[model samples]
Target: MTRPEAPHALAITFFYYRDLPRAMQFYEDIIGLPLAIDQGWCKIYQICPGAHVGLVDETRGMNKWSAQKPVQLCIRVVDVNAWYAYAREHALDGLSELFENDQLGIRAFVFHDPEGYQIEIQSATRAGA
Candidate 1:
C-alpha cells in the first residue's frame, strides 16, 4: 500500500546548472534565494516563500536538458514595483527591465543564471500600466 502524504507540500522543483558552485551563486546571490543545503557537490536554493530548486551533480541523471530548456517561472509577488527595484539594485547580467503584457497582466523582468536558465521575476500589476 502507498504511504500517506505529508500535511505540507514537499517542494516545487526547477532545473539548474550542472555546476554546483555556480548554481549556488546564481540562485543565492543573483536570484536572491536562500541556500537551504550547501553540500560540496550539490546545493538547494529556496525560490519562493516555501519552494526550493535543487542543483545536483548529475548522479541522478539530471543536469542536462533533453530538448529545449525550460522557460518562465511565474512566481507571484506582493508588489511589482519593489520587485523591479530589487532586481535593478542587484544589476545582474541579462536583467531585463519591467515590461507589461495585457493578456498576462503583469510587469516582469528576466535574468539568466550561470547555466543560461531564464528566470523571470514578475509582479501582479505595475503602476500606470
Candidate 2:
C-alpha cells in the first residue's frame, strides 16, 4: 500500500505541569529523552525521529490539572523490560509489571511521572505486530 506524505516535519504532544523543572528532570534524567527545544516557559524533548513532547509550566500554559489528568503519553520502545527495570530501580510512582495485551499486540508496563502523568512503555509483541 502507498502512503501519503505527512504534512509536518515533527509532531509534539504538550503537557502542562505545575512544576516544570521536576517534569523536565524526570523526562531528561529518567526517561532520557534529549532536549530538542528550550523555550523560556516550555521545554520540548525529542521522543524519537519525528516525535516530541513539550513540558509547559501551569502558570504559563493555557490549561491546569485539577482533580483529574486528561493525558496519557505512551512511548513505543525496543526494550520494554529494560525500561521496566529502570523504573523499578528509580522507585517511580505507579509502576506496573510488564504484561502482554493480545488485543493491542504489545508487551508493556505503566508508570507515572513526577506530576502523576501516566507514561506507558511498550514493545511490539512481534515484528510489526
The CA lDDT of each predicted structure is 0.68, 0.90
The C-alpha RMSD of each candidate to the native structure, in angstroms, is: 4.0, 3.4
Task: Report the lDDT tens digits of candidate 2 across residue range 1-129.
Answer: 878776878999989888899899999999999999999889999999999999999888887755477679999999888888888999889998889999879999998888888999999997768
TM-score of each: 0.70, 0.91
lDDT of 1 by residue, 1-129 (tens): 998876776475656455667777666776677887666556767776577777766545345543355675656677767877877887766788788887777777787666666677776664543
Candidate 2 C-alpha error for residue 26, in Å = 0.7
Error of 1 at 129 (Å): 14
Give residue 129's lDDT in candidate 2 (0 to 100).
80
In model 2, which regions exceed 4 Å deviation?
Answer: 1-6
* Candidate of highest lDDT: 2
Regions more than 4 Å wrong, model 1? 1-8, 38-40, 59-68, 126-129
